[model samples]
Target: MGRKKNQAMSVAETDREFVLGAAARLFRQKGFDKTTVKEIAEACGMLPGSLHYRYPSKESILVDLMRLALEQASGSLSEAIKGECDPLEQVRLGINAHLELLVGGSDKVYVLLFEWRSLHGASRQEMIDLRDRYELLWSAMLKSLSSQGLIRADVDRDLLRLIGLGALNWVATWFNEDGRYTVKDIGDFVWAVIKDGVIKR
Candidate 1:
């Protein structure tokens, strides 16, 4: 009986993932605001009521998508920088990993990046908390650089992080997966300007 119950739960989980994947494609094609739960149900070939039973609403699916995207992104960067000690190089590695991950999962990242403003109430705050955890990785890197006198001690660390990471984060807006420059090349280009200004001579 336990094994049978586990099989049933696994089937339900698979169905839930299918619904989320279908919604992600639809959300990518249509902006989050333009997407509807019925549209997602149609895409999934499931009854609208069935999809609603799984997600309750389109917004709930969106929040799940965003949360999953950010979690993956954070994990990618953390993995890329593992055992690396040079702060500037860590930032560059992080930037490269983030860009690659964004393009690799562009559909989900697109929804997370552009549809954030559509979220409301607890959903919005929950996403923000996850996002903050991701930003803290950059924050720690910057703080370490400052401790070593690699960057200007007088500059506000928070503002420097804002400007530096802001530039890196915006790559999702214009980066081309098929472009001549690879994601790492783009990261190197951005870091060239970033490192020259901040690294202690």
Candidate 2:
């Protein structure tokens, strides 16, 4: 009985993953407004009724996808910060983890960034809260580094946050595996700009 129950649980987990993965692809291709429950269900090779058994609506699927992405990103960031002594190393790890999301989970990341606003009421607010909390995590690290006199005093906290997020968020749009600059190269270049200014010394 225990083995049977475990098999059932595994199947349920696999189905949930399937639904989210299909939803992410559809959302990225069509955007939130254009995608429908029927479309997503078809994309997953399931009927609408079957899809409804897993998710109540298209919006719920998108919300679940967003939740999965955020959870993964939070986990990565947490792991990157563990037992790290240097503030700059923390910053580098955090940025690298974030950029890796763009590189590895581009479809989900793109949908999360562009289609998130389509989520309504409680769902929208929940994602917003999670995103804001994530931002605070990065900002806290930056502030700590500045407090230690590691980063320059002239760095504006809000401006730094904006620049960092803006730079990383759009990475999925233009990033190519065959491109001259790899993700690591891009991350390092961005970090150098953040640490040092554009001016020649």
Candidate lDDT scores, in order, read: 0.83, 0.83
Q: Please give the clash total of every predicted structure, in order.
A: 0, 0
For model 2, state the Cα shift of residue 74 in Å.
1.3
**lDDT (Cα, tens digit) per residue for candidate 2, span 5-52:** 999999987888788888888888888889899999888899999999
Question: Per-residue lDDT of 115-180 in model 1, one digit per residue for the tens?
Answer: 888899999999999999999998998888888888875678888778876676687778776888
Native-to-model Cα distance after best TM-score fit, residue 174 in candidate 1, in Å = 1.9
List the candidate 2 regions with Cα displacement exceeding 4 Å: 1-11, 198-201
Worst 10 residues of 1 by lDDT: 101-110
